[model samples]
Target: MSGGVVTRGRERRDQQNGQNSKTTEQKRDEEQVQLAEANSLALTMRSGLQAISKEIRDLKTEMKKDLTTLKEQVTEDVKSEINDLK
Candidate 1:
């Protein structure tokens, strides 16, 4: 009877260990999936940021050109007024 009890206990422990191993594997797989999703999101965000940066640069260039033209026009107008005064 003592030997039978010991054997049965060991069998139960082995079964429990197997179940625990399966649970741990599932958790690992879930973590990998989440990691992949996070990586994908990060890549997408980087791409979007790059696009925004390009757009901002283009806008700055256009604004600089407009400012230059306006400055030239103002300078010419001021010169004309000065000539009239003279």
Candidate 2:
């Protein structure tokens, strides 16, 4: 009877160990998937930021051109008004 009890206890312990190992494997797989998704999201965000930076640079260039044109127009108007006064 004692031998039978020992054998049963060992069997139960083996079963529990197997269950724990399976759980650990499942958790590892889930972590890997999450890591991959995070990496993909980071890459997508970087690309979007790069695109925004380019757009901002283009806008700056356009604004500079508009300001130069306005300055030239103002200077010509001022000169015209002075000549009329003279």
lDDT of each: 0.99, 0.99
Residue 47 in candidate 1 has what lDDT? Answer: 100
* Residue 15, candidate 2: C-alpha displacement in angstroms: 1.7
How well does each candidate superpose onto the true structure, as a TM-score?
Answer: 0.85, 0.85
Query: For candidate 2, what is the lDDT?
Result: 0.99
After superposition, candidate 2 runs with Cα above 4 Å error: none
Candidate 2 local lDDT, 25-74, one digit each (tens): 99999999999999999999999999999999999999999999999999
Q: Summing lDDT over every window of 10 consecutive residues in candidate 1, give the lowest-scoring window.
A: 22-31
